[model samples]
Structure formats: structure tokens, C-alpha cells
Target: MEIGLNHYLVLSTLLFAIGLIGVMRRKNLLLLFFATEILLNSVNIAFAAISHYYGDLTGQLFVFFVIAIAASEVAVGLGLLIVWHKRHGNIDLDHMSTMRG
Candidate 1:
């Protein structure tokens, strides 16, 4: 059977769901960042598949921008995680409650 747009969308939905669950259940800063990345990647896959199906470049272009944003997010988020880990000795989300400004 030929793969179609529906297949890609289903996969994307599954990845997004997994990411959402990870975000909700994970307490470690690093793990949370990974979950967020999964979410971004899922959207990128959907965008690419739709672009290909419609014979348009816009969705593909958006995917490129999303990738760029995800890369920046990873850089900033990992930097923050590293610093937080060093300062607190752990990257638990619960521990961040004391960081209120």
C-alpha cells in the first residue's frame, strides 16, 4: 500500500501525544526539553507531508523555520538546564519553585 497524507498525520498525532504526556509527567528539566523537541519535530513532519501532498512550498518553508526555532530552543534550554543543575545539584521541576522573581 502507498503511504498517504493520513498516515503522516496519524504519526504526527501520535508523536505529539507522546510529547505532551512526557511534558506533563516528566519532572527533570532535561527530559522536559526532550519532550518539547519531540513536539516540535512532530509538527515539522506534518508540515512537510502536507507540503508534499499539496505540491506547495509554504509548508516546507514553515518546517524549516520550525527547525531553526527548535534548534535555538535547544541551545537556550540546555544552557539553562546546565546552569540550573550546577546551581541546585538537581534539575527537578519542583525545585524551581524557589526561583520566583
Candidate 2:
């Protein structure tokens, strides 16, 4: 049997679920970033699948922009994480509660 849009959508949904669970359960900043990446990737998969199904390039183009934005987010986020870790020596989300308003 050939793989179809439904298969792709189901896979995307599963990945999104896993990513959501990870985001909800993880306490570390680094792990949270990974979970967010997973969520972005799942959406990318869905977009590409639909773009292919419809023979349209819009979804694929949107995926590329999303990827670029995700990359920039990772770069900025990791930079902040490094600074936070250097100053606090830990990357736990609980530690972030001490931030000043």
C-alpha cells in the first residue's frame, strides 16, 4: 500500500502529541527547546505532505520560512541559555522563577 496524506497527517499528529508531552513534562531549559523543535518539525511534516498532495508550493515555502525562524529561535535561545547557565550553573525551569520584574 502506498503512503498517503492521511498517513502523513497521522504521523504528524503523533509527533505533535509527543512534543506537547515533552514540553509539558520537561523541567530543563534545553529539553524544552528540543521539545519545541519537535513541535515545529511535526508541523513542517504536515505542511509538506499537504503541499505535495495538492501539487502546490505554498505549504513547502511556508515550511522553509518556519524552519528559518526556528533556526533563529534556537540560536537566540541557546545563547540566552548559555548565559543563564553560566550565571546560575543550572538550566532548570524552576530557577527562572527568581527573575525580577
Name the 10 consecutive residues with the lowest summed lDDT in model 1.
92-101
Per-prediction TM-score: 0.92, 0.95
RMSD value for candidate 2: 1.1
- Candidate 2 residue 99 C-alpha distance from true site, Å: 2.2
Which candidate has the top score in lDDT? 2
Candidate lDDT scores, in order, read: 0.92, 0.96
How well is each residue in 8-63 modelled by candidate 1, as lDDT tens digits? Answer: 99999999999999999999888898999999999999999999999999999999
Best by TM-score, which number?
Answer: 2
Task: Show where candidate 2 strays beyond 4 Å.
Answer: none
CA-only RMSD, every prediction? 1.3, 1.1
Badly placed stretches (over 4 Å) of model 1 are: none
Q: Using alpha carbons, what is the TM-score of model 1?
A: 0.92
